[model samples]
Target: MRSASPAAPKQLSLPRLPVPELGQTLNRYLKSLEPFILEDERHGGLAFQTALNLRKKWADEFATGVGKLCQDRLLALDRASPNNWLEDNFWTNKTYFEWRVPLLVNSNWWLALGDDEHVPLRARENMTDLTPWQVRRAAWLVHRVLSFKHLMDRQELYPETTRTGISLRDSVAKMFNTARIPKPRCDIHSKPPSPTVFNAETQKIYIMVHGWCYAIPVYEPTSPPRLLDVQEIETRMRSAVVDAQKRLASGASAVQIGALTADGRDKWAENLEYLLELSPQNQKTHRTICQSLIGVSLDGPSPTFASVGQRALTSHLHAIRSTHSNIANRIFDKPFTLIVDPSTRAGVSGEHSPCDALVPSMIADWALAEGIELAQFKDKEPAPFPASPPQQENWERLDWVVDEKIKSECVDAMARAKAIIDDSDANVFWFKDYGTDWIKDALKQSPDAYIQMVLQLAYYRTSGEFTATYETALTRMFKRGRTETIRTFTTESRAWVLAMLQTRRNLLHHAIHKHSSLTREATTGRGIDRHLLGLRLMLRPLNGEEAALFDDPLFSRSQEWKLSTSALSAGSLFSGTGFGASYEDGYGINYLAAPDMIKFGIESKSACPYTSTDRLKVAIFDALAELKSLCLATDGAAISQSQRAEISSHL
Candidate 1:
């Protein structure tokens, strides 16, 4: 009953990330400002006008002028380097993954792969079917992922396109040969910024098995890079795993150098220099590890979904990292990583830069779906092992010169990393009652808009007020673009949530439409949030007076996101995906919507008083229940039909 594979999607020539018109951005900014401006401030007309005019004048004059100059600079960088603008402005300058928290602080995702027994998922709410995996199956699944990597490298892999035909295929290139390199020095005054390097030509993967690690290259270097077959891949993996476990059993001292990557930027810089200064071989070894295309960790074992996700999320935070002293033995800062345990064939853990969550989500989704299909080959002819003699050795164990300094720092880094993991809490749950298709087909509403409404209602019911909410809207419609924040806690949304709570059906549809409209604007690259931030970054050094807008009380308050949520629907296969909250007071919720179910991964600082993932889960369910009841009660209502028509017309 399985369907035939679809034809490959054609790549699109998308336009570059656009700069918003100053006037449009200012108007949007003022609209967002309304909720934050107090009743008292509204009556104090002079002060309000002064503040408004000050922001307007700055946006019109300095911000626009400087924004243009920065845009030009970014354009020049892009011209020099195809995707340099993204790296230079955002990833290079702003993303200090090293300087921030330890490795696990804000950069990892634990994913459970799709299983073949569809009946189990159809039956159980707790999803008890996805546990107790075997080592052979796990190894075979890893080979399946490797095959995916081969397709990805050749650019033959299916490119993801939005319903309206925006091709996101180009972003896949970043998923390989991308890594974060540590700074050479620690001092702010002395050390220049160290950037992550991207080199797709380095078609190699780093594998961590047991407590040991090895680098394995994919190509045979036959004029054009020839990919190794699944048999060869499995052979290499088995050998490597055996050798790794052997070393561990023999009680060989671990280098534990991966700990340096988990430390602060300055500390990492200092340790990196010390490491390089130790020997020429050390430098070569370090480069080999940092520049690899991706990492594949063959973890030991786990029994359940919760056990696997928790083990991957927490253990990868500091355990595998600290235990594997050398970067070669540990997972480096690759754009893509596959952390698979032999015990549980289905789950994979991913670690990457904070902003690039979508890349890993894509990889995970593809791997799980493809993995299931490949598993059907259990009764068929097995893939051939090495056809002829293996060309060149693909695996190498790193030699490290570990000292007292390295050991001391590694211990401290592990402690700090563990503290971060300990302070954070994650909750994973599934809303099996309904999903996107149900919302669209049954209720006749924009699924995304409906979900956003659900989030708004959940937060309102829990907190008793609308705090600033941020929903990441993809602006990849433009070339070399990243993301723009959709200010979800708008006046319309607030009104809608209030009305929805009181079962006031009249305002609910209007609110949903308005929310969808704002989301559309952001999607089209007309959002105010990022434009304003870009302008501020451009004008920061030159104008202190205008820069005062950033320092303003109201401006600062609005920037503090109380409810930070982003959606990644990687079909029904992916049970959940999540990241940490940006601020301590906020809750970070990443929701995955399938055809008939929705999975939410709620995360918050355990210390935060206002937010509890458990309570939020309850609120979210309640909100959905209330909304569903409203839809049923008003099934024959004229407004529902008319509003659906209006929404359909806009689409």
Candidate 2:
């Protein structure tokens, strides 16, 4: 199929993400501090008030001086660098690369799209009944990639926009050929090496099937790029899968190069050099896989209708980036993976990093939409489905030395990776009773704020205290901004939770007001967290006591995100999304909000007894019922038992 780029939107119509006024941001910061301030009189006359006041004053003073200066410097940096200052600074944070392990406890993010969208009958009829559905899936994936590339070329792809009209189109590049390469020892104590971003013109992708990898050259040698037809693409992938399966059956030893990619960079680096030593051919193969556009894992023999439990397992494997059992088939940790579990014709998983989950979710949605349309195309639609194409141009299978030592290491690595997957506790809760739209229409509440409040109530019930929770508010509305952590455990939110529990009616309205205000501040880039982070980053290079602000006990405690949350309103694209908890004792909550239902992908550390997904799910439902009852009670109306039963059944 010929490439047809989507028309780019008018650039002037979109506003650049804005930088907030320092004074305004500081005022919002002060308000956020209200929740954390401890009352001295309640705790046996502890000097908590004095400490809180001191910190507040410090924050007030810093906003006028260093914070303002830092903003100016950040602006200058943004202008001076091709990459936005925040983009470079945030991604290069040593804490993310050096301090955190790229394992189950940190770094890895996972998501799966919804299966609700239907494949039209015309597309079904158009499909060659002879070709396997799974094989056709690979072709569809390639078609989606070509479509995305087309949009990227035309710059027609719509950028993410807030109500204020600020756009985050710049971050879209992370969806393609970028790869997160490990540099374990080169500079472990400092910022890890930036991920490798490849030229988009290189339309080449690696296809992984049955623990074997093959390079698929997607673009033809022409002045302007041309993509291969679906039929041609399908034939090549099917042949490669057959060859890989045959090789496996014949006891051809598979070198588990991918396992190293999952390990700590320093260990990976040493092992990689040793691997290349065993056979020089490995280096070429490694480069080929590493540098490809993206990896499409054509998974075999899995049921199409993967339950939330099955998805959790698959997500774990995908998030691992690469493992021994999956072989070193995955090329990049950051780029999107079109993970097709063919037997069930299920969804795809995008590896997080390089970009946020929303971007990939939209792309996956687009891919699915395109697949459906292509399926419906008329048989005489002039689309070429060749019986065969030049085999050499389509695929290449690399050979590797099968050393016993490598084999042993692969087995051990596989065990370790599998343990993390096995130990993981992922509970997918599909709350079909109602979703964001209902909350908005019924209670006049922001869906996000409503959910955050629900979570606060749930956590309170789970552990009679407010933990440091993080809700990622998109700051992409601001220039070079990434995210601002909306501290969900506010005084207002806590009060609302207490009110719901005690049946204290009037406070719920006030809680919604406060929560929505904080959400606005956070989304508009005036949140306390990112501002403080920027100020701290600026203070790092200074040689004075001001540096102590970062070391302050309050500073450390405030940033300790016990519950890391992100809300992706995937529309109909995802039934659920999930990722690893940011903290060992914490939980990672990625949720999808549809019109009538909201599905939650709750992931927690299995080692943490305090965090149970099942308990949290129940608490969430309880909170929802309690809040609705309280709100409805104001009008002297109560939910009927039958309605409650229906809601309970869906959860």
Candidate 3:
């Protein structure tokens, strides 16, 4: 990228927002993370554990927000349509419900990303012919799945204020963080900067396109992420430098002097003003260069991303989120090899559900139906006497799992809703005083359907998030084989749509084959009870008044989340981060954090509580431990030899 400022602008300028002071410091922080990937070999297991702990921490934080909402004293009051109840872009809910999620998303994910990428993703991909809702719904799923992972438990709903005059500080911080590059040791070995053509080298550009997933806390879906996230990334980087300069100029002590060196804060200001401000220009160039490479990781079973609507759907998603999060959390073991083939390390063979963890209970049912009284030690293996037909045709051929009658019902229900959903001039339907009337009865709508409705709402809301793949709801449906799967579940418009809920149910698996193991859930019911409790807690409304909204059409159901194909991503959400940190590292943002988080591998925390100069080394050590724990565990998380073999065959 050219270093010179773009044709120096005129002196007159538009109104300028106050610069956030942590910008450069944030940029420097991101730069510090660059070394993280490079040093991964030095720290793997610990990183994985750290991720788990982090997920727990985030989950706790989310739960705390819900707890606060539950503590509110508001009662049921019917809100009418055309009232302020469902007004667009307003965060009018109580703080426990509104401020909590906003604070979380803003403080954690939004702030960090603002510091790292500097922008919040805004544009919903606009492809017209495909299922725009599915594309955008996938985005919400990404957010839900990722956020769910951070909390280990599904988070309760929280809300946020309108996007107006949003906080730019978080994004500014993220940009400063993104600009950070690795510090070089006195090098015996170093890759010299690629030679510039003579003096042309100076003009040569390098843009770094960094993508990783993090859980942001938001009470509602509005706030600092009002603009397209990429733009925010670019804008925030510049803002960070300016903020750092101002902070250094103002002499803030807590603002550490220099991340690269122990120089005075003044020196940091100088580097920031001179070196950092121009860094984004280089990054922008580098990003352009790396843009084509963004989808490379899509082919394999890897961690993916989130959607914009997650902030809006807040509590609604918590229902299925428990199971969905679990899938995201534990779905990436070596056994995941079955999701995508091993050869490409990116694409799947589509021989089974991309998430095989979904089929366990079904498999167990199949075995039992055949009168195969499975032995306690038996995995997916048959009993001493096998049934007449070892398996059904549906098992071998992915098609016809359900009868034509079931298929017709589902497809018809989905098609009817599609008619209204596809209309171009449809006004967003909502009513005021919904709390008393609609919200009062809204929960009557199936939670499963409610979950799908939320997703559908999100999809219809924006097409700027992802490219579409299907034409009609019935197109190909699920191939039961290869290619992008799409299908119309029902055209009735109200058949208790639970698009992705089935996925949640699907995630509950039984030990199949030699390598699989069964938990106590098969008989005792204790484990399933606990899981159900966790899910209930996650899905419950903040309080009785808020509960009413669950009944309202505007406040109710939508769509589901699914990766169209193996070519997009192998694993889901935190299961993938650009730096490739272990899932334990993901735990930081994956699950709800608890008091134990203080002991969570120090590196996994948003702000390491440790104040030692050796903090970096300690963090690295913790990450290594987490990775090792992953492979060595028999907790049903470790990838098994048999599972890998099975996956490789499909690949």
Candidate 4:
């Protein structure tokens, strides 16, 4: 199903992630300080040259002192590590698992799948029966996902490579049958002993319908397991749906055990301990869900919007979080949960600890790439078949026994999740004006760098000051490589923003070029942030003393990440994607630069007085328009001074 051919090399054959040179990291660190120094100069603090000199002095001292010691220890670590020093030592625990927040909107990432052309989006108003199109679509998706897993287990899935033939790390092995298990201080990834090997016992998947959980087998019992056909899976799913409806109609209520996973990590761990202690059946159920191939949530219909743009995309993303009425209908700890609403609108909400979002997104992309009409069941009618009802024994309902205290805690967790959801100001903006095609072909610019400039202009225009910005850069060229931060708010970027405000276009190309250079450095694993992080982490073990370079006030101020952004593949198979803001007053922005349109998913906290998603949207629009005009006017012609002045006035 992958776009690549099967002859690609295996991931284990790739080179190990290397430690950046100590001197190289130090030089880059000093360069990154320029923006902060400039800010201090503008704010009437230290003069620019004096401040730069002071920072350089600190860097030079640290480079020879504690920094050198940390670099030596890091080199030792790199040699000791089998795959990646960062992943083996620091990344998973420090970056994700040790964070105590609930995973719902705070840590999990969501991807909105493009609508199925065969099942058009329709109003869910007063719809009572389950849409056959929805079930069929869900079945088709499940089949494709399992097929992807099959390819992965068989080592047939093509390994991704850079244009220059460098193989990217393959993380598809971690994409299924994995769950983030909560512990006291740090969570752990629970996976099968041989995660990459296909196991018949774990080929079942859990489906949630009407707040009830059902475990249904997805593979036939045989020597070489065969996947169930779409009709078989759909029948099993329909039986679970009908059974759940009947149980609810008869006044049976689930204990809402799933909500426990959405609570704070420590609390969730405590509750899980108590829950397992209550009964062995509960422990078995938990293990079953954890080891399942994947989770599917057959959600009720989503709210309809007037148009299929910002509002519709926003609603769809919000629903995928299972925040309101369906809060208990989700296993948030699952590595990836497939959510399908009525009318077959679907997306994926995934736990962040196992692998990066891009890993699971690859599966989603492949599954959605081919339409249902091309599947084996193409000849079947879109309507539900009148076949005999599924056997009740085919699936088992998972139930939990809970005391009054546990019930009360579930209520508390649900309320906390609701409050967080209510406070989030999130929206999707479809910038249809133009996209990477025009930027690359017409303006001869790197689309990513140009967009980073647009973000700089937008943020400065909205807040009157530039702050730290974060963009994700993949380091998958190495074994077990994950990501490195690309700081987007550089000194050159700041200058370009100022020039844009003054209608001076000379600095535009410089800013974009700098951004592209930084991006290249990050992707090749010469990034400054991760190296500094490694050094800082090594200090306590190497020596008890702290270093002045890391202790400087500007150091913390420069890494606030007020603007957290990332871009995926062109995302023609996805409507949008998003994650929570890194800071309360900041914005979390994810975008897809399609050929002709760019889709943006922006999130901020409404509780933060300094942030407004709508205001930021307007600024983004204005910035894009202005950048287009400026590029067009300056691309190939030399304009007269009066003509330039006229354009500046309009700008």
**Best model per TM-score:** 4
Q: Write the per-residue lDDT of candidate 4 for residues 1-651, one digit (tens) a residue.
A: 759657854434567778999889888988888887888778899988898888889889888887888899899998998887899998999999999999987889889898877654452334564566677788889989998877665645663433212332247666677789999999988856464576544878999887788898999986687899887887777777777777777898887777888889999999999999999988978888888889998887554422355667777877775557777889999988898887577899989887788777888998998788635664465554334445656788877778998999999988888888888787887899999999999878899999989988998888888899999998877777889989888888887786665554556777889999999999899998888989998888444767888889888988999999999888888878888998989999988898999888889999998889889999999889988888777743564687566443322
lDDT per residue, candidate 2, 1-651, as tens digits? 989998865445433444556677666655655556542233455355676677667766676666667778767765676545555665445435553353332555555544323333243233322225555655666677667766755555653323222343555555565565555444222122234543332466777766677877777656566776776666677667666766766887456655555555566656666777777778766666555666787655432223346564444334332322443444335356676554324444454555676766666677766443445323423233344434564578865566777777666755666566555666666777777777889887778778887888788789776777898887665555667678887667766665554454445555667778877877765677765665566663544426334555656766778788988864465545677777767778888777788777777777787787778879888887777776665642444566445433311
lDDT at 181 for candidate 1? Answer: 62
Better of 1 and 2 by TM-score: 2
- lDDT tens readout by residue for model 3, 419-445: 311221100111111222221153222
Q: TM-scores, in order shown? A: 0.79, 0.81, 0.16, 0.92
lDDT winner: 4
lDDT of 3 at 35: 21
Q: Write the per-residue lDDT of candidate 1 for residues 1-651, one digit (tens) a residue.
A: 999999876555667656676667777877777655532254464454566676666555644565556555544555665543454464434544424444454655555555444223322233321112232344455556656666764555753343222334556555655566656431221111133443333656777654355777666756566666555565566555555555665787566565556566667777778988988877866676666666776554333223345444333333222222223234545555565443243444445543356656676666666443343444333332232324454567755666788788877866665566566777667787888888889867888788888898898788776778889887766665667788887766766665553465545676678778888999887887766665555544644324444655767777788788888863477545566787787788888877888878787888888877778889999888888888778733456665655433322
Worst 10 residues of 1 by lDDT: 185-194
Candidate 4 residue spans exceeding 4 A from truth:
1-12, 120-126, 159-169, 195-201, 303-309, 382-389, 541-543, 635-651
Clash statistics: count for each candidate: 9, 13, 157, 0
